[model samples]
Target: MQVMDPLTSPKIGGNHLFCYALLFILIASHVSLSASARELKVEPKGSVKDLVQSSKATKIKRTVNGLLEVVLVDAKGLKDTERFSGGMDPYVMIKYKTQERNSPVAKGAGSKPVWNKRFSFRVQYPDYAGGNGYKLILKLMDKDSFTADDFIGETVIYVEDLLVLGAEKGKYQMLPTKYRVVGSNKKYNGEIRVGLSFTPIR
Candidate 1:
């Protein structure tokens, strides 16, 4: 003997169908509009002052030292913003680069000195690497809001040859260099400007 429930069967079937239809429409709309929005634009503006060496090095030197500075600015041209978090704590990194076209990922065993926004930071270069033409990348961020909001600037310094790695016995001359200011933010939406310094020691 078979018993059929007429009322409950139709109601349950209708509910399931309604739920499935609603889910399908939502998913379809999400797929269509996912790629139709405009991306944000962030720009940094600044300038790098100059590179100054403590005492000139001799030929084939193992260590080199110098000073770097950058003038901070804003989008409105020299207008100070709350973005700087009051002052900048600067940092400098010297990377042993393989070629002139290599990037930060190709760098190794770097040094970051304490930052000072007087547009001046002290930098130190290592003596050994596996290749010629080492690159110097300089960066700056907020001393207080380093993890929150701040500014960052970078410039490259190129050394001549790997042979100069040990040029400690001759006149160690450092050339002049400069960088242009630029800015970026991953959490907020805005534009930035500052004088950037990009001086590569070649």
Candidate 2:
């Protein structure tokens, strides 16, 4: 058996320690980047092409009903200049406007949707003006006990009558809508997609 002296053993050098630290940082950075890439869950179910807007009516031809989930991300990787003094229980608010006979019956019928911990909402289309056409504006709210902040991202949904469509070919068609967002937080970025199930009226 070979014996080695404890005091004479080669002491670890600072350079060696530094090299170890560098390696550790590199590995840690790689791991962190990989984790972030997988952290955000964003998915698009079905094709947006399936959504078409009607020319005759100001509403989309298809009936939409189901779950909607969104993720908040850093669009520009900007930092928050102002601290958000808002509560953590964020919610989704759906505001609708129904138009029939070139008249607006419902201006803003708002609903506070049931939200999951991840800030997701399951929204239902309401019956408006005898099942006629309706236009919707959806917004998010950061809620406390009695206060709310309007979310950065806002979208519009045009809900049409179920029984009859306004397509030229007398066939069903989809609609087009847009969403826009602006915020003070440089890091605050968001994207959303909805999972829906459609039922035709008999």
Candidate 3:
């Protein structure tokens, strides 16, 4: 067995020590950078389509006894600012209390949008909100790209007038009644054409 001298055997010179220190620093820096990278996260923003789908999910819990049926015939004379490439796309959001329904997109309809879409909202008489002078609010909106839908105009029909007008005519069809769509600064933007047929369910 041969033994080497402690003092003369491969002494760590200043150059080797400096190289070791540099290697240690490099390794530590790489580890630190890796840890920092692992902690970072990026969240994504929700799209407009997502919002539309979510809105569809929120529905009303209908009551059984003495329900009222409101029919949505069609809409006309809606003026919307052009947003999309070709033309404006519009849709209707029909809301009453906890009940809500969305009309199909009026593709390339521009100002004159017609959705002959029908939606039924159930309400118990006496306990019903429509009988209490609450009007049916229709918000004509333009669907945009990144943001929420833009409001084109709005029209509200008195619920009391709906049933009474039908009783007076002796039929459900309340004629082609034109509700003036009011806009910003109380200006008349356009008229929305809608019909009401009240059916009292047993």
Candidate 4:
């Protein structure tokens, strides 16, 4: 067989080279796509759960130490606890944490009594080690000369939210609001009006 000139011959090897290059390109494209898919994959749901739990574990619990000022405004429709009297000698016994205060008697003020007195207490958020202390108890009483002091009614004021707000803002105030007074019989005997303020220490 006669040999053909190298340049004049048909480029038979070109098709094979092109086929090889096409195969190589397809393989490289597949590899690049697979890598991109892996990079775009979302983390497992379990990992997301663990991240949320970690966030909660790192969250800080708020604590505060401050001064609390209370204003004893007045009471209305109190259960006249006196047996036979012109008007019951009404007074208030205020209790907060372990501290106690007594208001001067609203002598003969009867069903509606007004004290408008101010009292202060040294206070702490999480007042006890177990942490549930922001409560104020007001016990209405009738002074008696011969018998035991009468328990007219009582009202409880929860100051946890107010204290927390004060701690956040450095101070907070609550205008006089009425709270229902409950008697030993567990009935709403009257309503007591009071105001509160808290100031946090640096």
Best model per TM-score: 4
Candidate 1 lDDT tens digits, 11-78: 56877777777998999888777755334445454212111221233332445554333333322121
Q: What Cα-based lDDT does every candidate model obtain?
A: 0.36, 0.38, 0.64, 0.82
The number of clashing residue pairs in each candidate reads 38, 7, 0, 0
List RMSD in Å for every model shown: 22.0, 21.6, 19.5, 11.1
Which residues of candidate 2, in runs, are more than 4 Å off? 1-87, 98-133, 146-151, 159-189
TM per candidate: 0.29, 0.31, 0.57, 0.67
Best by lDDT: 4
Residue 130, candidate 3: Cα error in Å is 9.0
Better of 1 and 3 by lDDT: 3
Model 1 global lDDT (CA atoms, 0 to 1): 0.36
lDDT of 3 by residue, 1-202 (tens): 8786443558767687677779989999999999999999976775534433443344223432333354555556666677446567888787766677788888878877777766777654224553434467788788888877777887777664344332333334455577888876578888877766655554
- Give the per-residue lDDT of model 2 (tens digit) for 1-202: 9786433446756676677779989999999999999998886663433333333345444554433322222122112222454223334455433321111111122221222222233334444443324544444444444554445444445544322332223334332212333343533344323222223332
Poorly placed runs, candidate 3 (over 4 Å): 1-67, 83-86, 128-132, 164-171
lDDT of 4 at 107: 90
Report the C-alpha displacement of residue 173, candidate 3, in angstroms: 3.8
**Candidate 4 C-alpha error for residue 83, in Å:** 3.3
Better-scoring candidate (lDDT), 2 or 4: 4
TM-score (C-alpha) between model 1 and the true structure: 0.29
